[model samples]
Target: MELLRSLAAALAVGVLIGIERGWRQREAADGSRVSGLRTFGLLGLAGGLASHMPESLAAVIGLAVTASLVLGYRSEQARTASLSITNTLVGIITFALGYMAGQGLVSETLAVAAVTTLILTLRQQSHAMLKGMSHKEVESIATVDYR
Candidate 1:
């Protein structure tokens, strides 16, 4: 019953982030290296489940999964141009924290998760503006003769 509740909380957190990503069309069509809201939420639940195991084992598994997600995103970004994995990872961690909150481990997990979500959500606009600036710079340079 507790596990179910934890899972539900995790899924809710995941879905919240997922809805945003899906609405923004942040995922790739090929689905190769992308980790959207659902993936992140599931990963968090899995991490929570793993936490039930021995502490050392849980820590190792969590770190391994987090590292893999990061590396996978880096590789995917190099191969194809799209949203970075940092925000996705943040979502995953947020979901995990939500699960922890559901399990009664921490009192402020929801607040922390909300803040993290906000940070991730805002990143899109900052990145887009940066890209736009780069584009403007390139265009301006193109118009100026080097010779």
Candidate 2:
């Protein structure tokens, strides 16, 4: 059925993203990371499942997931003394993509997932680029882009 296809798409997206996340976090000490392959996969599945429900139900589920991610972020920060919200944002995105896939927007979901995976996988390069950039240069670019 269509629902099965959606769920499959969601699962594939989760696993695809998870491969990158898991690879990045593989060296981290266990229990330090907020999420890895399994958690992301479940989040995607949850989103897909909720997508078939009423709009209010889906909204509530999304809000609840957001709150949970926020709490997880706080917990991670407390443990590590420093943490980025990138994982939390990815979680939200994964969920949304799953919902989109469930709604039969499979191509768009796959495209976004590919872009998200690329971003997540390029953390080191991204950080290096940011670190190498001067504040003035960043400001200039931002000002020009905004204008």
Candidate 3:
């Protein structure tokens, strides 16, 4: 019924995110990336399910999921010396959106998810724009404190 609908919404949120994320990393060799569509989908599902638990339990579960994603990011960063935290942040956001869905906030969840996916989808264009910028152009916009 309602729960099923919520879960479906939650899963949809994950799929949306996963599509963008997977597309962003399409150049990476197979099995190279730590997460893809299925992983994101599962994370969303987990968040929705966690919402059904008692309040304290839900909080604990949320913390655990966040911690795990952070730790995984840290581990990958250390191993590869990569500085990006975008994937981890996306995972956390997806989970939150799923939790929102479970709480009967499907519209809000979808809106946020759409925004997040848009950001992910714009990666190449953003990088291209940055690369096209002159040094002075970048310096002029950068907010650095002289003092």
The per-prediction CA RMSD against the true structure, in angstroms, equals 8.7, 1.9, 3.8
Candidate that scores best on TM-score: 2
Candidate achieving the largest lDDT: 3
Q: Which whole-number lDDT from 0 to 100 does residue 22 have in model 3?
A: 78
lDDT of 1 by residue, 1-147 (tens): 776666666566666666555555555465652656677666666655665668787678767777777777767777877675665466557546754755655436556666666766787697887677877787887799877
- Candidate order by lDDT, highest to lowest? 3, 2, 1
- Give the local distance difference test score of model 1: 0.64
**Clash totals for all models, in order?**
0, 0, 0
Per-prediction TM-score: 0.65, 0.90, 0.85
Per-residue alpha-carbon lDDT of model 3 for 27-136, expressed as tens digits?
88887777878889988888898888898998999999999999999999988899999999999999998999999999999999999998888888999998899998
Record all residue pairs in model 1 with backbone atoms less than 3 Å apart, i.e. clashing: none
Overall local distance difference test of candidate 3: 0.90
TM-score of 1: 0.65
Query: Model 3, stretches more than 4 Å misplaced?
Result: 130-147
- Better-scoring candidate (lDDT), 1 or 3: 3
lDDT of each: 0.64, 0.87, 0.90
